[model samples]
Every structure is written in C-alpha cells, then in structure tokens.
Target: MFRALAVAFAVVLIAGATTFLALRPIEQVHSSTPVAAAPLRATTTRPTSPPTTTAPPTTRTTTTTTTTVTANPVSVVENFYAAINERDFATAWALGGRNLGRSYTEFVAGFDGTVRDDLTVTSVTGQTVYVSLIAWQTDGTPRYYSGWYTVSNGEIQHGKLSG
Candidate 1:
C-alpha cells in the first residue's frame, strides 16, 4: 500500500531517500568502529517559500426508493357480494356483513330465495361505493337494486341497497 504526507516546510534529505521535514539541526556522532554513514548538515533559518495548497478529498453518497399500493374501495363491495354469491357466509360476514346492521342469521335469511347476485359497480365517490345489483331468485325472478354503500378500511360501514 502507498502512504502519503503533506509537508509544509523545507524538506531535508537525510541518509535514506525517505522524505521528511527536519524541525531541528542533525549532527553525526564519531565512533571507533568502521561503520559507514552519510555526512550531516544543520539549518537554523526558517523556510522562505510559500506553503503548498491541496483540494479536499472526494466523498460518495447512496440513495434508496420505496413504493406503496392501496386497494380500491369499490372492490371491497364487489368482494362482499362475491362471497355471498359463492355461499361463503363466514367470508361474507368478515368482509363487511357484520356492519350491515343485522345478525348473521338475518343476513343469511335475506338471500334464502336468492340464487345469484350479479354485481356491477357503477361509480365510487371517496369512501362511498355506488353499485347496480341483479339478485337472481330460485323462482327465476331477477330482483334489481341500486344504491350506495359507505366503506372504510375495506369494510362496508352501512348500505342503502333496495329493490
């Protein structure tokens, strides 16, 4: 790996080629052994050159995105009727039948003479869902209904559907 240093003053060339800024004078010691060493020099005056300048290091940034989706309120009304059409009473109850202002028995009794519920959603205004319903009877009579249902959190809070 490479190493770096930003020297601001005059650089001194010592024995080795490594770069360094000498803050004080350097002297060589006399020895009796025959060891080889480079000559030494000292400097007492401050450097007259201008200081060097460098730009700051660069940085990187990261970002992430997320998305959310919500179901349509009219679909809830469509599902509620779909459960009834499929004869799944418990599913119908949980979907919003319990909020239709009637007991579970009464809710089931309302469809005693009914054979099928062909549901058609006309329009949706905020939390209110309007629909056109054709409830086919066992006697082959098709009953027509048109009304709006109040829905909140995917559940029918109330309904005014009638023939």
Candidate 2:
C-alpha cells in the first residue's frame, strides 16, 4: 500500500513538472442562464494522515495521495479532476477535493470503481466555471455529468455537479 502511495505521489509531481501537458479547451458561456452544478453536499475536511484500517489479525494497511495547484481558478478545477484521474486523493484533496463533500476516507472511497475522468472547462464566469465531465467506470461505461465549480484563489470553494 505504501509503495502504491509512493507511485501516486510521484505521478502527481511528474504531471505537475511536465510541460507537455494537454491544452484544455476553454470557452465563455453567453447564455442568460448559467449552467450550475448543484452542490451534492459541501464539506471540506483536511486529513492530516492517509486513511488506515485494522483487521482481525491486528494488522494495519496504509495508502497515498498527490496534488499541485495553479493560479488560475479554472485550472484549480482542472487539477482537482486530474488528481482524481490519477487516483491521488491526497493531491485531489489539496486541489479542492474537499469541496466534493465528504471526509478524506469517504471521499477516497467514493471513487472506488472510477477508472478515469475526462474533464473540460465549458464556461467561465468570474470565479464560477462550468464543466462537462465523463467519468469512466472500471467496467468501461462512460457516464456524462455537467456542473459548475466555484473557485477562490486557487482552491475550489464549492459548487455542485450531477449526471
């Protein structure tokens, strides 16, 4: 578990340092009605340590996380999903995974079967950015979801997303 965590952290660092990153599409929404993702629930909990559990044999297991932030508010949302894609909950939490509305452990557990997230910034209105996401499950099913994320500075403040 610890080795896996190390790999996840390294992935986040390499992704952050790598300059050949894909350019994410950006556009402004001109509609009178803004596309907003309703808050599933807003709870930001910062866990000092990764989650762990004990078994009947009195053995414990550990895990890992990863993240890096950019100044652009929209980029914050992008980074958040990036961490999720890498299965780096630690980095995801730092990148505003807290806004996903769950404790660190629960938040990590939430993406149990999620394989990857293909994200796009559909619109930007001040600190609010609308997003369209395709969450792929391990079974190879793609679920479409659209929502908005409210960012402050480089952290995701809160927002809502639903499929």
User: In TM-score terms, which candidate is top?
Assistant: 1
> Which stretches of model 1 miss by more than 4 angstroms?
1-70
TM-score of each: 0.58, 0.55
The alpha-carbon lDDT assigned to residue 77 of candidate 1 equals 86
User: Which clashing pairs does model 2 show?
Assistant: 37-148, 37-160, 38-160, 66-91, 67-91
lDDT (10s digit) by residue, model 1, range 1-163: 0112223222322312232333334565778877675555544443344345555788988788775544578888888988999999888898789998999999999999999999888998998999999999999999999998888877888888878
Q: All models: lDDT?
A: 0.77, 0.79
Look at candidate 1 and give me any clashing residue pairs.
none
Candidate 2 wrong stretches, greater than 4 Å: 1-70
